[model samples]
Target: MKKIIILFVAVLLLASCENQEKVNKKADISTITAESITQVINELNASNSGIDKFLMEKGVKHVANLWRDSDGSEEEFKAFCKKNYIADVTERELVFQKISRNIEIITGNFNKITLELLEPVHLNTFEQHAIDNEFGAYSVDSHWMNDFYQNKIAFIIALNFPPFSLEEKEANAKEWTRKQWAYARLGDYFTARVPAELLQEAGKAAANSDVYIMDYNIHVGHLTDAAGNRFFPEDKVLLSHWNLRDEIKANYANTNDGLEKQKMIYQVMQRIISQEIPEKVINNGKLEWDPYTNMVYENGKTIEATPEPNERYQQILNNFHANKAIDAYYPDQNTFIKRQYDGAKEISAEATEKIFTDFLRSDETKKVGALIKQRLGRDLEPFDIWYDGFKARSGMDESKLDAQTRKLYPNAVALEADLPNLLVKLGYDKERAQWLGDHIAVDPARGSGHAWGGAAKGQKAHLRTRISEKGMDYKGYNIAVHEFGHNVEQTISLYDVDNFVMNGVPNTAFTEALAFIFQKRDMLLLGITDDSPQKEALKKLDLFWSAYEIMGVSVLDIRMWKWLYENPEADATQLRDATMQIAKEVWNEFYAPVYGVKDQTILAVYSHMLNSPLYLSNYAFGNVIEFQLEQQLKGKSFPTEVDRIFKQGRLTPNQWMVEATGNDLSATPLLNAAKEALEELK
Candidate 1:
């Protein structure tokens, strides 16, 4: 799932033809002095005796900071605040309701329009044209912020609904009512006034990177060894990083040629990371190539091949520059990292980092690693970070599972049809399950599947799952189930929540938690039940091990972003080297002791680094939340409990966790369960 930018809600009203003179003048607004802020506040307070000093100070400062010379002089700023400021609690609440309702209508419609416009780029039904690509990158709402500022809609919001810091929300949220929460969320709407062109450029960079990743497919059958021996079937094709990694995991039970296939996939990943992968070998099955030797051949004749020229790192560089450009607009949460955490996620980066670091460095991680080694009867390799032995399906042949899945879900429609049945299998009532299923639409994805939640109440949440022409294979089915979980969350949170302003979960991690819950039951939905007495124990270990691996990747992602901020002028090559070093350092510190290996760059191979940008951490956070929810729902009704919990809607992470599980987000439960599971297995 892409990280939703909540602030975009305020900026989705851009006019088609912006006044360039006004925009040019507004550029000097950042130069507004501290004395100017004080002057506006004192003058406004002096005139408005009904308004409190706190409100006067906050409203004036927020408005003045965004006040351009073109907007008006300081006198006009004071007059606007004095006239618009609502002093009565009841009156202010009425104003909040009106603004919130209007925003929902505007943002919801804009979201629908944007989603429809990008269908050509997002879906793979036809060859995307140059115009389609450009259209996809062109954000219709990019100029909305500029338009809002020019028309004083943004200032009205700032003046009436003063923003709260994340800390303030956390500290006061417990005592706040539903209306108060809605008001606070409204405050979140207009904190920053980024230039429309910068937002458009950022969108373009993201769209281009997304296109690059979506098209990055490798012809597995065309892969040749140093001895010119083909291992995979002629028809097999896999997307870089996702399917390739899944293929490696799927082969752990293949005693005949699985290890060799795993080795080859690892080689391909290394080539990709080092930018030494053959350019022609990507998404092209017309040429035969030896990944290990970096050689290409056509019709049994040698062919020269060029490397990919660091295009992967170039995408990351573009995202970094684009995000960096907007830093100035966000004075409080200046960096992308800060905005992702404090603004969107409502969780501090430092807190999440500590949680991950503590878990990765724990002795429980070593116990799970040792258990994996014992299960494999061999030393762990870098690729073993994705070890699949803990999964029940690991013992079964992937082909048999794939055959079953293919037969059951022959197309996207088949899976969509069965969503209610799958939900029922997880203990949801038939009626509610059917209702949820009706709100979800499944589509074939061009790349690895992702779930896109509907922005409006009636809009259907889309589950874009990758389905081969042959059918939905086991790996694709597994991912579809995971994405189905996202759709379910999206549907429930949007349609069932009490307030439209508080429709979604707190952050992506919360939805990811629900997705993990649904994903762990994929086998149950397939009528494959494990009656092992140690089933619960195995589940605990699985969650622990998965969390352990992703936490390392998450740390690496955070460090990479920090590195990018430090080296603003660094090119793609420099960034790549620095990324590799950071990945190795993270592995050596946290993973080497457990895996008995050092200096591995495999942790840096996640495709999100290039495309999603700082999203990998949510997976780790999701695992933690999933484990806590799992513990709470041990004997509870799955659907009832899920609905009860998720409908709480957009609280701070800790507060939401406390309401759902009676505790804050912690790794101790998982760690404790892993310890017990290890003992039981022994």
Candidate 2:
């Protein structure tokens, strides 16, 4: 899975934007009068003559914005602010430290609770039950924010540390100390006082979607051509999107029929995109499916199979509705899109779009595509969008690698045992590796693997991946290694950062960057080193191609959401059509010229689109960051650099990038390196 661990409480806290008047009409929760806010600020400023007037004004306004009638009367609200505001710098720090300590306890334990509840659904530990879905979807922390407000804890924080807008944060970033940044993050919370019910409902929608995607597996073994020829193993079952895409990559080693198998997988992906796949065939091995004909057979007899009734699109629509429910509550950010980009990711949607599109349309893209075509000695097909030829693993027998991995890691425990050894292979000292390994827990995943970072220092980050009874296959091993990268970053960032609030990197993309770095060195950890003169150049080419593929998917996801917001009332079928259209449009614009194919819906096959909501861009951004960091890591101590870089904590993306590598995050480095690599390889 491209997704890392999602903090459910953070998800609930996140809010979007709407028109101020529209928001007021919907909730009208804030009841504090303008006169009351001014009076409170004036009184506080008079008593604490040395306190910053601007801070006093901002804190009062911030608290007043989120003050609900249920919280207290205007007089009570004024009294609460006057009584709680910390005027002295030393007292304010004390308050901040106490709140941070309590927040970590609350968030960490809540995360642990969610992890435990999700075990049955997320891990392959036991037989699943219907109740598992309900339990997993339950939002334990939904009412926490409301409780905070009612107890006046939220007011105290807002009154003392008013939140800063994205613009303000960026403008003052250079001047703000780490403690100031941590305080600003505190300000980020309690600004949006969304109802607990809406939060729970949204969490339910997201959880259901997660379950839907996790359980969506295709019995590829049961798939056959019209001639009754089967290509995949009889026991082979692949999850939608992740395993299917990996299967396509693995097949490149099949010199005899690689293209044929890839085409079959592409056909399967199209059926999934169009929702024409037989519903009975999904996650059911007894039924036979011929994706090309969109037919199903039971007991070798033709059977009538209903198409999956836009359920894929329904998941997206559900999430859209769930998030839209809380739109009115966020006075500052009215749209979920804004919250996702500006609030959570700390990157604006417009800048992200430009980054992706510019890289997608770059001359390097076609140059790389042309090189891939020359290597293949054939006309490009749509599935060539995921061609993995540039990687060193290309043309290697994946089955042999699978066998090796299975032998090496017979179970999750075996992998867990070797975590430190793997880290040592990356140049970390044995002691440091052992510390990281002790801090990370590995488990058998029911779905494709993901890294769920720890919410606090003492809590162990979890690396969950699929492992068959036979053993961990190469695909699982590869994903495990990637997640290990995330675990390492998550551990260092949380435990080593000076402030509790600055516990993570800027966003998920930064973690993804580390994961990519670790994944690229997978073979080296296995004692398989490439001494070829073209090794460095090949690496750049691979990164360029990987960026090209994921960036298109990211662009598709972005456009799909834009369409969703524009036509929010559209039903599932309408969403299906709009999504597919946007996918094709992205394909035509960025991929058609390279592939000599148009209208391919392959980009729409990412499972993340249904659950993670605007997460695909992180992969695109991660690729760029990975390439740039790899450039900076030349001849450096890998583990030392990673530890130092991640410890910089939750600065803005560019700030973190510059501090880490003396350069801002950009695709320019990757593009230029790819241009050089192309010439070197030629």
Candidate 3:
């Protein structure tokens, strides 16, 4: 077991890009003076260099740190910052030098079109400000279901560069249509998340929550669930979070070779992930989240990463087990891609196969031993096993999480049934409460994981971006709690701030703070506690286990990208070998000492490496912030205090954390916290 818990690529937040459905709707905000709106929209979009050169990059210490060095390691960061003279944020100064604002009116126009499409439960829009274009302000005034997937797809559309194989103009055009269709489908999923909430408690009654979401129709055009009409959907419901993904994959899988391309991409990624072929790997994909990644498999097999290396690989592998950051770059090699991947050894196939065979022996499969084929079929790809397997391991039934969440939050449609409740709980009331919740949770679906959308306050409409998690589990629920926390924060900040457009928080990490506040409730929500000494021990285990798991994987993500950039033309086998070498190196360094495992890349079972790129950093960021906030919230009577922290959306993560915890985003807080908890284990 390694440290990392969450998986996937570079995700900050959407820069409010456009999602074109090829149809425009006139909004009711005609009285607000279109000329004035157009001027502001044009100003934001027309800058030549954008906010006077890296308006997105100014004072961006935290964001800067995440991308500090090409190496993507702790040492590289220190050296890079020292060399570049980058300044970390101070405790008192609320610096958000890098919160991105899409100056392109096209981005604003995209929001406007989305706003006009809202219906049913309109989010409060009048009191809250929103980014408006020549068309109208993107209001979160009405119920819009398919918001999650839309924003996720939109974010991709906005950042996706032309494929190396395709023409730039053609690529952009294709991306435009791709964004629109993805958004159109995502609207369906939001309805799914809500309906799932409603159905969880539908019970024998006619006016149950299922009736609520079914009435909402999360996946608009499809009007169905992944499990089908008879499943959660026909029950007049869809489950939130977990099941919501089922709907998207089942319902909206792209037909025009899009989803297939994604599948191929994931399959090829297995070379990096499972086979560990590349020896040394790095992503020049320049995809959203780029991480330096590496891989090594221990079938009791040995590959000499460096010359004159015999038991040295064993020593490094042992150190890697310990999670100590070794400054060795593995350099370049003629015989091998990197010093690590250059080895002249290989683990026997039988030993590696033995390990996998044992995993298959678990009681997880119902058909049992008859299933010798672990990588079953196309549907049962190796990655599917990782995803589905872990899901089954989670005590909760994959189908039941949403049903259970609904039972927890009644009197409202979903957990976020009404965004304003978060504000109201935080101490705001009536107009202020309604204004933010309805607006923020209801913004047009811009692509990005867990992006909270808001319409102008007082106006009635709703929209929500996707809270992304496909191969996620109990951890994903924690992530969902955090995402919901962001939604709550978006609700409050948009409602509270003066400038509707500038009302919300800046950067992806602020909402992360809000989510962290909520995720602590994992054990609390489960009604478990550090009661018995045994239970307390278990709690510590979960943290260290997740962290240990994630860290190695994070190491792989970074190493792989670095390899790719360095070896642009490494064939597929070469890619697999490179990744394997790094994975082995990371495992040896991080986990070997702690768990006493000789070699384990089990944590590499992350989907992010398959899909979203360079994204593992945020989980590290989230863990850091969560630990920092937990330290502050420990003895404080922060009952509704969490809400106030959330409402300060767009405050810039660095500034928000400073205000919330009087600190900057750093690993020390988490490291310290983990150490304390580990001491309890002692």
Ranking by TM-score: 2, 1, 3
* Model 1 score (lDDT): 0.85
Q: Give one digit per residue, the lDDT tens place, for model 3 in 1-682.
A: 2343333211211211111111122111112233433433343335422232222222122222113122244443333323332122231111111111221233344455554533222222222222222113122212232232233322221111111111222233224342322222221112111211112111112112112222221221112122222112222222322233333333222234323323333333343245332322121111111111222212323223311122212222222211111111111122112212111111112322232223222222222111213322233222222222111123334345544444544322344554555445444666766644455433312221244354445433233332222222343344455565666665566555433334555444455555656655544554544445544333333333334344446556666666665765555556555766777776565444333344444445354443333345445445555556666766665544665565543333445576666776455444444445545644
Clashing pairs in 1: 13-144, 14-143, 14-144
* Model 2 alpha-carbon drift over 4 Å, by segment: 1-25
Best of the two (1, 2) by lDDT: 2
- Mark the 10 consecutive residues where model 2 has the least summed lDDT: 12-21
- Over the stretch 1-682, how does candidate 1's per-residue lDDT look in tens digits? 3454866644543431342443444453554578767766677667666766775577767787778777877667666777777767788878777876777777878788887777787776657776777777888878876888899988888887778788888899789888778777777878888887888878989988888988899999999998888889999999988999999999999988888899899988988988889898899999998888888999988998999988999999999988887776777888999999888888788888998999888888888888888888888888888888887888889889999999999998999999999988889889998999999998888888899888877789999878888999999999999999899889888888887888898999989998998888888889999998988899889888889989999999999999999999999899989999999999999999998878888888899999999999899989989999988898988888988998888888888899999897787888888999999999
User: Backbone clashes per model, in order?
Assistant: 3, 7, 156
| Highest TM-score scorer | 2
Reference-based lDDT, residue 38, model 3:
40
Deviation (Å) of 253 in candidate 3: 33
Candidate 2 lDDT, 74-170, residue by residue in tens: 8988888888888899988998999999999999999999989999999998799988998999999899988998888888888888988888888
